[model samples]
Target: MNSQIKKHQACYTVADYMSWPDDERLELIAGQIFDMSPAPSIKHQNITGEFYSQLKQKLKGKSCVPFIAPVDVVLSANDVVQPDVLVVCNPDKITEKNIQGAPDLIVEVLSPRTALKDLREKKLLYERSGVQEYVIIDPLEEYVQRCWLQNDGHYGASEIFGSPEALALQSLPEVELPLWEIFGLEPPEPAIIWSG
Candidate 1:
């Protein structure tokens, strides 16, 4: 753990988190503060926007609503995260202040600064908090990894998809995201067959 993070671990709470300046982007997990700094790259922003756009278009007028980042999802007093993209199916969790419970789906676009934490710490947090689906996109690699909560109350192994494939979301059956479009990649050409 970073020395600064070590100092804040098991010491900070949501109250302290709320008292911070608006410009400071931080996530609290198990009472530890993780800084979201340096801003994301243009590629990262584009990918995040594409994912949100697709979710918004698919979920329009539906009970499930999609949200972009900077929205607090309060899993507990000591656990709050702002996923890059998220979907909440229950209206009650959508509060004027922040989401009070787990979202149905959470997406995090990996950045070099936060990739390991997103894959390990945040993954465990979402699993224990009962998030139904979690997606991690790597803009550099142009691939996505997804996991869902299993009946055993833990996340199953991640299912990986490349840019050419589409991801069918488990939380919302009707929603499928084109990975190529999301990653800003050219879609694979259709296969041709010779007539017999």
Candidate 2:
């Protein structure tokens, strides 16, 4: 018997990726599909964990529900996404099936395979969707960059930060999250980096 060949499958939209039953992690960048590496990098996990801890502590009893992936975020009918950490504050937006609307905040840790798409395609989607804040953390660069969308419904200039910068999220006017925590990446040193 002769072995038959298989045809390559094509995914032309984020919706196409979302409807698949298999748990093959993937994301669409400007309608071009990219397979996600299995499990995020350890450095990425640490950063995400630190951010989640800070956010969970601060948003306690608040309306915002912070979702850690593998939660599907539908940026559009065909542009589904999964940010490392996403905050949904609008009660009507949260749903039993999915986050049906714009998230209040979104954070994604960058990897070599995903850096370009996250910085461009996803960034634009979040902006147009009225996600109030978008944060992109680079493990290699040790950088956390954020953009607080302007009232005109688009992101203005961005705020670039490093280990020393105290991350001030736009949605939480009164709270300031220290960068040292998010980038600490491990148990903090006995000595505090800076006295606030």
Candidate 3:
């Protein structure tokens, strides 16, 4: 619980969120305000940048567009967030002020301060909002966890990928992420198999 909740008696909405100072880094989840202070670590930024760069390159000239954080993703009037990295395929959702709907893919690089919220509250929000795919990267652990929206409209069990593996995106079948490169790790040597 690194974030402090705003002490408003009433649940906040986008209109209230928009009225706040632009300098304040905050997120509204189900109308509750969560502070996003003490900016992320350098390692977090590095991993986020690398992942975004990879997605951008792979999605170049494609219908989907990639965006990094500080851009608002307005899931609903009261549910707005700024995911670390996101890809939105629908042009109509890309409004001048903010993204109007759930993005096709979202990536959140976990920091000590925001890990719990990202894994719990944000996960539920993204799932409920119909985000096609959600990816969580732990810079410290050098691993990734992914959740894809199931047929029944819920996220299925998370699929874990270690630093040595590549993650195939469900929302965009053409895209794959090199976890080693993303984590800035040396690729593990191939295991030598001997004939029995």
Candidate 4:
């Protein structure tokens, strides 16, 4: 755990990334190997799971297929990532090994350890790669921020949405994602038995 395959100090290739052990969770961004160790928080997992379930249900008979994390999304020779959830409409891009290109929609649930990279580095990379929609969910705030790739090849202003409000997917207008179902943490109910 102490040692990480640092990115800036050493340039890594996709082949090197492929040869890494299965236990090691890592990513390659712009030829830099980034260690994605330290698993996501419980809340992060909850949000990701619920959101993925909803997406899976919605895309059930459709061309778009939903994939959960730990699946390599090969953006390029130097850039490979594992988004929390992704929807790939192009079947050809999805091979047994990994997603060969940018997914139609990529969702990243922000955690303390990954917020900076998810919001900044990955945001830029997704936009440049022409991902149709990029969704960033803040588990702490319980809100989802969305960015759409514009006609000019740039991401437009992000639209922030919270619980009770639906997180609309620009790429797939028919799909409805209610924030409460994804990020809501309901309190436990009080004991109903009365003292007789």
Candidate 5:
């Protein structure tokens, strides 16, 4: 241990994260800064795109707003995160810079590098911030796990959904979608061989 070596402190606030120059892909978790991985895989994008497409059609003229990734969701001044998908009905809450307050729904598409963080860190943050619903999307297993914030806590009454089931949301009642559609990928063909 060298006396001159000093560890860099983690960022705990949205302002702390936003202060950095562009090109830093990071998220603030309960006053801690975690470096995010690169872009998502093709499968991740496909599902996100598919879900966004459906939500757009279903949520038309509705109060529930459907938004995709790259949009900052500020849980608090000190806690700002960019969830994969977020819906905010309060137009007044949507600020010119970022989401000023908690949204109705927060969605996260899990990746290899972000699985643990998404399941634990992000989940805790969303719950504490009062997000109505938090969705954890796993493209690897083609599953979408929805975590409803009940009793002001997380990981309770969480629903894990798989194929043949449609996603239902209390915030967006018009959201009607099938599992196969969200994957938006063609199934593998049955193995066959030329028989004599």
Candidate 6:
């Protein structure tokens, strides 16, 4: 291998990652840098916002806190990521700067720009980092799949949910998200009706 390439592959730590320019988005996985570009689509943003709002509403006055994107979750010195949505039940792991460890539940909304990495690399990273649950949302397909960390420290079989049913968070069963509402397929029940 060439010296320049080898030098670049020497595995950057969290300190190195923090020192880089923030003009564009990037992720660090296993000491490798992955560029996040092309910006998110409208559907992706909408889906992310829906999930965040629902989760935030459910977690109100609760120990578990929900965070949206651009919040750094530091999995390791060599691995850091910004999940679309993350819920942390453990207060100690959270700090003003970033999450110091794995969150209880993490959600990533799929886009053409990040589908592969979110499913493959980020999946493995979260599993290894001891995240209790990982959810992948495909906005275009209107499907959500989740995998829970098994007792053996690996992810269990995936549970897929499509339109027509609300998504029940295994980590937070009390919180049920109406998928149809989130995807904007069905109108929310009318709050009130006036008859004169």
Highest TM-score: give the candidate number: 3
The runs of at least 3 residues in candidate 2 whose Cα sits more than 4 Å from the true structure, single-residue gaps closed, are 1-15, 29-31, 185-196
lDDT of 5 at 143: 82
Candidate 2, residue 73: lDDT: 75
In the range 1-196, model 2's lDDT, one tens digit per residue, is 1112111545356556655655566665455555676678888898888888888889899888788877777666557777899899888887776788689899999988788878998999899888999999988888889999898999999889887667888877756888877887443356657768
lDDT for every model?
0.92, 0.78, 0.93, 0.87, 0.78, 0.89
Decide which is better by TM-score, 1 or 2: 1
| TM-scores for the candidates | 0.94, 0.83, 0.95, 0.90, 0.85, 0.90
Mind giving the per-residue lDDT tens digits that candidate 5 earns over 1-196? 2222223765356666776655656676777766675788988888888788888888889877788888877777677788888889899888888888889988888899888999988888888888888888899888888888777465477898885577888667667678778876554455689999
Clashes by residue pair, model 3: none
What are the per-residue Cα lDDT tens digits for candidate 6 across 27-135? Answer: 8899988777778988889889989999999899999999998888999999989999999999999999899999999999998878999999999999999999999
Clashes of each: 0, 0, 0, 0, 2, 0
RMSD of each: 2.5, 5.0, 2.4, 6.4, 6.3, 5.6
Instruction: TM-score winner between 2 and 5, please give it.
Output: 5
User: 5 or 6, which is superior by TM-score?
Assistant: 6
Please identify which of the two predictions, 1 or 4, would achieve the higher lDDT against the true structure: 1
Clashing pairs in 2: none
lDDT, residue 157, candidate 1: 87
- Give lDDT tens digits, candidate 3, residues 46-109: 9999999999999999999999998999999899899999999999999889999999999999
Query: What does candidate 4's lDDT look like per residue over 26-46, in tens digits?
Result: 888888766787999999998
Give the Å error, residue 54, model 5: 1.1
